[model samples]
Target: MTKDPTIAIRDCLAEIAVLHGIAAQKTLHEFRNDAVARRAAAYAIQTISEAVRRIPEDWLADFPTEPWGQIKGIGNRLRHEYFRVDDGILWEIMTTDMHALKTVREAMLARHAGAS
Candidate 1:
């Protein structure tokens, strides 16, 4: 059975939110210093990016303002160029970019719910 793209995106967003919340109280240094937390964040980011990539382009077109390409690119980099992962950029993404994605995900979910 095929999974709904909206649900997949929501799941990924929720995972990212949970992982971010786990590391929310820590400083960048603390986050970077902890291998487990760092790996969790990276995995969550990759997951979210992968989901974003799978979502249909027409569906994505509805949200013209979201950075879908960049988000998908980050996932590509994370999956393909694992060696060059920058903790600082990851920290910045977790702190800033993710909130926007979460908001968008919530909107998508609500829209999907209404359409159902």
Candidate 2:
């Protein structure tokens, strides 16, 4: 069985994203003030961004269902507009946005795994 690059990247990213979500949920209260939680959340977003960035164009083409561009766009915004980021938006993204991403990741993973 040939290993697909897109699936590999997606699986790796999904795992990290799940970890980030878990961490974010665990520190929902403390994240408002705790430096560690803030940093961790930032790092989590960064990693998710990196995953999106690393996805090759060909691989992106294969997964029509996933919001590859949007995910990367958010990452670009976060990376470029660090100081201008609003906490409320970030909180909403972490909670609501991440769940949507999680669904996409799961669907892609299931499809790829089934294909294999």
Candidate whose TM-score is highest:
1
lDDT minimum window of 10 residues, candidate 1: 107-116
Question: On residues 1-116, what C-alpha lDDT tens digit does candidate 2 reach at each position?
Answer: 44454655565465457546655566556556666655556567766766766555654566687777777776677788877776656666677777767766565566556444
State each model's CA lDDT, in order: 0.81, 0.63
Q: Once all C-alphas are superposed, what RMSD does model 1 give against the true structure?
A: 1.7
Model 1, 1-116: lDDT tens digits are 55677777777778777767856778999998988888888888888888887676777888999988888888889888878998998898888888887888887877776342
**Which ranges in model 1 have alpha carbons more than 4 Å from their true place?**
114-116
What's the count of clashing pairs in each model shown? 0, 0
